[model samples]
Target: MAINLVKGQKIDLTKGRSSLSSIMVGLGWDPVETKKSGGFLSGLLGGGGGGADIDCDASVIMLDENGKLKGKENLIYFGNKKSKDGSVVHSGDNLTGEGEGDDETINVDLKRISPSIHRLVFVVNIYNARQKKQDFGMIQNAFIRLVDNQSKEELVHYNLTENYAGKMSLIPGELYRQGNEWKFSAVGEGTMDADIGSIANKYA
Candidate 1:
């Protein structure tokens, strides 16, 4: 069974489980539905009339021991699907959050991560949100989860239930190293950061 987490909660990832080397981080969301005939959902369903379909892009930032970015190649997203070291890989962008399950996923190899890397921050942002007039408030049922890659067993899950009105970016969760072990934390925080570059600049 997976442990459902609340905001600010943290759990051990590879402490007791010596065999846990790789894991998958999944993020998902859906566009808010409206009663009107044509809207975002309609656009996604192939009908036309609503505002443009929401394009939410999921990304990961790999930080060093100081919790800061050391290189540009450490950022993983649709354009850059994998880390230079191959420790982290992204599943690519999801133009519409119309799916039933995870819209995007990032795979992490614990043993392959460099010793200097200490944190993996999972984030999601609206593509061209400022122009498309989209935000998290327009999205619903957003969640992030961690799963055992080999066993395909979910380990931790967090549902972001807060109202992120006018927020273009979300920091769903993070994985950080403590000594030689890794842990997961449910961040569930929202920000107005426009794009991945602006968000990464904060740590750079």
Candidate 2:
């Protein structure tokens, strides 16, 4: 089961084995360039003729009890890196305008993780293309959500729409146990031209 988490809650991860069922990590932003093919010359010059586009990847890292990167083999991925037979562990990249399915999902097998695992770290990266110059101008409405497996409840929702000038690190807040449920929330928002490590020092 998953426990509901608010702004400032805590959970003791040393006890039960609450596996992660599903994760929805989303990146939303307004396109600074939205013109989509003005002319061949504009394209050649690399001007603002291309339409709005967002290319990014999201990742979640599970940490051991001592807050270290120990076991990563059990980490799951969705979008563009699911499985060989197309099982869709990680969802495909969403290149269109930001919308409902503009996010990636990663499913984890809780049974594989050690009971001492204490925290989860999420990282997002913006891909750079030839035609488009990556911009960190204005990113809005980005967050991470943890959902329960059995009960299908929204365990935690982390808001990361603030602090645009610098990278944000979201420490899990409001994690606790309610009967058989355990959950937490840690959301952050930011704009970057390259990888997720450019912002969060932890990833670097």
Candidate 3:
């Protein structure tokens, strides 16, 4: 079943018959532009920035019982590996922003997680490709969803573009579990330059 989660709702995983063995987190958004055309010459000559374009890098984190990182072993980050940053690894940065295929998918093996794990966090970063200061209002249908692999169910869904900030962020949704299925919802919508830390602080 597809579960639509609103802000402030909590899903108690321990109450479920099956203690979340694994979780798949998917980040998706409506692509602003499908293709980019022309060059600076075409623009300077009278073309202007061709087509609407939105590019981004995103990541996810898991919070342990003590409200600290479960380390790289418990988390999956996607995007550029710039400056050898521990969490900068990305599956692939989508430039087209076409909202197709898997923009960002993080698979967590619950078996590997210590019993101490308490929450999961998601973060999305918009690259500001156009270098313009715009808010999430310019975007549409952006969301984060958690799925159960065994039952093929959508455990939780969060609609963010309605009231989220552009740039780096912690997706304001946390998933635990409820009645054999995980549950989650947007908690507090806020923007931050630090994706990993902001997420960790929620449980901390």
Candidate 4:
């Protein structure tokens, strides 16, 4: 069974697993239902009534030993789907959180990551949140998980259950290196960041 994690918890990803090198990280969320449902009323409401689709873009900001971005190309999202070194790859943008399970996924090759890069911070932000007047308050069942890419088995799962009403972005979790091993931290922190670029600035 996969370990269910709470906010602030951390887990070791490559401690004893000698052969483990690649892993799949999945992120998912759903929009909360509104009683209004569709039409001009829903559009004006931003969501639920279905005025506009809540485009939550998942991104990974690669950082160095000093906890800072080394280059602009290290940031991976819908526009830039893969890392320059080819160690990390994003599945692509999920325009709408309309379906079940992992709306977006990012695959990481532990062995392929550059030695200088020490952290992979996973973030999710509502696209044009301020313009659309949307936030996590219109979202539900947000989660981040890791799977053993080779065996297709889930190793860790973190369901973010927080009241992020006015929040526009989330730093769900991150993978950082400790010596030769990688560790996963369940960081369920919400932010008022307007987009992925704003979220990446904190580490810049």
Candidate 5:
């Protein structure tokens, strides 16, 4: 079982696990059906002219020791699925939050990552949310977890159940370096700006 983490909590993954080289950060979420005040059939099916498949995308931003963006290519998402040095790789994009389990999985190799890169931040945003008028408020069961790839054991997990109506982006957590040790932090923060591009621009 994974550790159900609270906001602002920190976990040191590299403490006892000397063999913890690779980890899979799995993210999961489900869409909340928007109820409509219409006919019986419309209400039965929860039909809504506005409701549609919410496309949520997960991304990883590699930052230097000073918490600065290394480069644009370091931002891994559906657009750029792989990192430059092949240290970090996003599995793929999850268009809809329908399927069971993680919507997006990001793989990180401790050995492959550059020493200068201090942190890898995990972010999720609804694709074209401004056009869809969607945010985390309408989404439920949103979570991000870290696991030991080899052992198949979940190290830490955080489930977000907050009302983020006007926000479109979520800063779930981050994997950072503590001397030779690596640690994970659960940060469930939200932002109102549109897409991932706007969020990335802030760091650039």
Candidate 6:
């Protein structure tokens, strides 16, 4: 059975696996039917956008052992869809979370990631949450998971439920180096940052 993680939980992705090289990190969600379904958070974070489609964007911020950003190109998202060294790649933007399955994916070649890099933080934010006054309270079934892309084996996954109401951004989880092996953590953290740029500054 696949490991189902709760908030603050952690798991080892390379525990028994010898070759856990390529991984596909996925983030998904469904737009809220109406702000009324959530509550006060909807009032606090909703806008006069008049129920337009929500555009949530998924991104990755690569940090060194010191928690400092490695470089600009390391911020993978819609515009800069791929990392400079070609180790990490984003599958482009997902304007609306209308379809099934993951809305966005970050394909990582752990073997090709820079030796200096020690952590990869997975983040998600509504494309224009600030302008639209939207938040995670307006999204449903939001989750982040890591899978061995080659074997199609799911290593770990976490789904955000009712806790992220007023937040516009989420730090769902992270993949970091533990000794010579790698591990995944279920962070499931919500933030007030309205855009990806602001969230990116935290690591910069």
Top candidate, metric lDDT: 4
Clash-forming residue pairs, model 1: none
The C-alpha RMSD in Å for every predicted model, in order, reads 3.6, 7.5, 6.9, 3.0, 3.1, 2.6
Query: What TM-score against the true fold does each predicted structure earn?
Result: 0.92, 0.55, 0.65, 0.93, 0.91, 0.91
Sliding window of 10 residues with minimal summed lDDT for model 6: 41-50
> What does candidate 2's lDDT look like per residue over 1-204, in tens digits?
444444444544324543553334343344334434566434432465544565655555555555555433323333235422221145555554366533655554344334655555555655653234443332345555655445555555555545443332223232222334544544343443355344333432
How would you encode candidate 3's per-residue C-alpha lDDT over 1-204 as one tens digit per residue?
656766666655434535556666677765443233575433332344434555655665666655566455545554322212232133556664575544666665555544555555666655652354433433446777767667667777766645453444546566653324444657646575544544455544
Candidate 4 residue lDDT tens string, 48-167: 545357999999999999999988899999999999999999999899898889999999999999999999999999999999888897788999999999999899999999888889
Order of candidates by lDDT, top first?
Answer: 4, 1, 5, 6, 3, 2
Candidate lDDT scores, in order, read: 0.90, 0.44, 0.54, 0.91, 0.86, 0.84
Candidate 6 lDDT over residue span 65-135, tens digit each: 99988678878888898887788999988888888999999999998888888999999988777777677
> After superposing candidate 1, which stretches have Cα over 4 Å from the reference?
37-51
Report the alpha-carbon TM-score of model 1 versus the true structure.
Answer: 0.92
Ranking by TM-score: 4, 1, 5, 6, 3, 2
For residue 146, model 5's alpha carbon misses the true position, in angstroms, by: 0.8
Clashing pairs in 3: 12-177, 13-177, 43-48, 78-90, 79-90
Residue range 15-110, candidate 5, lDDT tens digits: 989999999999998886655547643443334544578999999988888888868888999999888889899999888888789999999998
- Candidate 5 TM-score to native: 0.91
